[model samples]
Target chain A: MKDFPYTESKDTRSGFGAGLHELGKTNPNVVALCADLIGSLKMDAFVKDFPERFFQVGIAEANMMGLAAGLTIGGKIPFTGTFANFSTGRVYDQIRQSIAYSGKNVKICASHAGLTLGEDGATHQILEDIGLMKMLPHMCVINPCDYNQTKAATLAIADYEGPVYLRFGRPVVPNFTPADQQFEIGKGVLLNEGADVSIFATGHLVWKAILAGKLLADKGINAEIINIHTIKPLDARMILESARKTRCVVTAEEHQMNGGLGDSIAQLLAREEPLPLEMVAVNDSFGESGTPDQLMEKYGLNETAIVAAVEKVMARKTK
Target chain B: MAQSTASETHAPEATKSVAELQQIATQVRRDIVRMVHAVNSGHPGGSLGCTELLVSLYFKVMQHTPEPFDMNGIGQDLFFLSNGHISPVFYSVLARSGYFPVSELATFRKLNSRLQGHPATHEHLPGIRIASGSLGQGLSVATGAAQAKKLNGDQSTVFVLMGDGELEEGQIWEAALYAPHHKVDNLMAFVDRNGQQIDGPTDKIGGLGDLRAKFEAFGWRVLETDGNQFETLLATIKEGQGLLGQGVPVMVLMDTQMGFGVDFMMGSHKWHGVAPNDEQLATALKQLEVEKASDY
Candidate 1:
């Protein structure tokens, strides 16, 4: 198994702020809008550096979505900042008609995603954003794993046209990905080359999958681990090729099993290759107030859960 | 037939007489009734109600281009249909003013046509800047476009037309607070105070009491216009345009009957989205005939 080390831990929202600040310096057409959550979203660097290009839209997510759509009309690439719940569900119609249907170039950068947005309860933590954004016709859904990857994805999406949903979390997780990695949308990164089972993970669960790979290696099971950052235009070729080698697959995410990374991978596998697959994700349940680590353990989204899922799927594989 | 040159780009010509605008509005009303009757599915009541306002803006007021339709619309005045159910009027004025072929009005709401049930930019429709069928979103969009104009140092205006019942949406109130606070003075917004919606009278559905006072409370420069009268509306728009660049956005409370042109369909909620049959179409056409202007 390939060892991935982290220097320190940092929130992915800070990565977005750093990337936005970089874009503010490089791209003149890049403008930022926030719905009264600059501090929480860690957008202070962009706001302070490019005060003229930033807009404080004040507590109206629907209006922010609309304004973002309209800004595209004048050839301005707008990045809207807010929480995951307010970004997707609170203004779905605004996004549907104004941004998605119109095919505007707006980056909906959502922070505090999934159960890791601890202690704020179910109202603030959003797990269904990936499903909601991916369902839109012209939307590109991306959930980067670590701080370095999130910053790289943020910079990469500025050059990409059309609507994008960049989802990141609030908690300070392991910053394991390379600092200068070229974040490619819809391209999966191979972390380990193994043949026993394939482990597909995204967002915060990616680091856990890396840890799970080591655990499986000790048990004489060589696990193939892949990080799927972009969810919508999934790296299907990479996933299928890995699945063909391993023959059994385990998908992990910090979201519901109903409409998340697991569901998307399962559909791809069912259509292309019939393989035994197990998902390590939160079952049909809402998240409540808890620490990020406690929530990951209780909801079965940690490395142990992924190891268990791999074992369960490997047992069901055809001999 | 002198072959109407009215559709040609009139480089900021704000001098067109009210009679000329009224003549175009009558022809536009005829197009609205005919287009809706052809589809048998559209909102004709609000379309007919807003006909004069659209005609005044397109033919007499807005400084825009029709030959080469630019999506950016940087140095040109832009318009957005907030309450996009009134697409019949929007489509009629756009086609009649030569954004596309005038004959394309026949393809309204048809399959594989650019004219969807709502105004959408996805089809690359010439005049539409953004898609709007869902209400309470246009004002915010227009405000953003206005901000873009300011960023580019382009001294052009952004206009948006909305329905009275659309105000019941919470986003409208959010935008109501946004424009004034942001000093989005280059945007001119109009509310079609037509007193009726699809469910019934707006008073019975959800009363929007005292719009002038409501807009004033939101720190906007409010003006009222008789939307059915071309002369009064042109004057009101001229006055409203004067209030631009004064650190406050402008709002026009346009008083209009639900079905303004056709006597039978007038002043009621029943015709809000209902199309006219053959006999009703003939009645509406007879009332909205223009001697000089030709129908598409």
Candidate 2:
């Protein structure tokens, strides 16, 4: 397995805050609106630096979405910050009518995605956001793995002129990706190349996939690892290429099994290159209050799950 | 597809006399009836009720270059229809004001038409800046646009219209609290206090008590006017414009009849979304007379 060592660990939300603060200096048209989660979203620096561009919308997600859509009318790139639940489900219709259907240039920046929002329980942990956002026609869904990757993605989407949904986690994860790497929207990152089972992961699960890759290598199984950052516009060519070489697949994400990255990749393989596929996702269950590691282990979203999924799929591989 | 680039022949706003506006309102009313009748599906009651307000804004009150319809509308007054069910009137006003060819009104609600049943920006409809069929969203958008105008240092006002029943939506109150709290001064929101909804009167369905008092409590400057009358409504719009940049958003409580022109359709909630039938169209058109009506 290829090494992806990290000197430090950082929460992805801080990366977003840092990127937004940097954009404040570079892009004059970049404006931000937070639904009373300024501190939670780590937007204090941007708010402090560019007081004029920051809007404290006060615990109203629907109004924040509408205002973001409207701000695009005056040529302002609006980034709305809130939890994933409120960002997608609570304001789905508002986003549908104003931002998606109208094709407004609004960035829906969601933090505390999936069960990683530990101690908050299922109410705060949103595992359905990726599905909801990807279903929108004009929306681009991104779920970066680490701090540097999330920060680079945050900077990259500002140049893209359409509605985008950038989701990141609450807990700190190993910051292994390149600090100066340029983010490509729909391109998959190949972490390790192998010939046995292909493991595709996103968000916080990328590190887990790398761990699974190492574990699989120890067991004499050469697993291919890839990071899919963009969910809506899935890197279909890369996924199909990896699947063709490996002849089996194991998809992992800190999201629901029904409509997450696994579902998108499954659909792609089902239509084009049919192969043995296993998914490591929340099996249609809500998470309870627990620590981040406890929730990840209990909900079957860890390196063990990925390694086990790899084993299960290899057993079903066409002989 | 040989269509006119409408801005070339557009007359300057504020140059049209009140008498000229009234004439255009008559034509707009005719167009609303015809467009809805052609589809056999649309909302005409509120459309007829809102003819004068839309005509007044497009013809005399708003400072806009109605041609080459750009999305930003920078340095120009922008208007959004929050009560998008009344799109028959919005489309008629937009087309007649030269945002697009008035003949395109034939495509209203038809297969692959720019004019959806509600106003949408996806079809590249020139005048519409945002989609608003789903209620209680336009005010927040207008406030945001108003903030954008402030950020760009563009001294133009952002106007939005919503139905009285739409106040039942929690988002409107959120916006109501937001606009004034942020000191968004360059925004104007008008509520169609026609006291009607799809089922029955707004008061009977879901009451919005004393909108003026509510807006005032939310720190907005309140003004009331008759929406159907050109003289009173235009004067009220001018006064609302005067209230801009005073560190408070303005709300105009517009009192209008659900159906104003046609004798059979006016003063009731039955015609809220029903189209004029063949016999009803003949009867309604006869009631609304114009010497030189430009019907699409």
Model 2 chain B: ten consecutive residues of lowest lDDT: B1-10
The CAPRI quality class of candidate 1 comes to medium
What ranges in model 2 sit over 4 Å off? B1-11
Cα lDDT tens digits for candidate 2, B89-155: 9999999889999999999999999999999988899999999899999999999999999899887
Error of 2 at A198 (Å): 0.5
Q: What digit string (tens of lDDT, one per residue) describes model 2 on residues A1-319?
A: 8888899999999999999999999999999999999999999999999999999999899999999998998899999999999999999999999999999999999999999999989999999999999999969999999999999999999999899999998899999999989999999999999999999999999999999888988999998999999997899999999999999999999999988999999999999999999999998998889999999999999999888898999999979
Docking class of 2: high
Q: Tell me the spans in candidate 1 whose CA falls farther than 4 Å from its real position.
A: B1-13
Worst 10 residues of 1 chain B by lDDT: B1-10
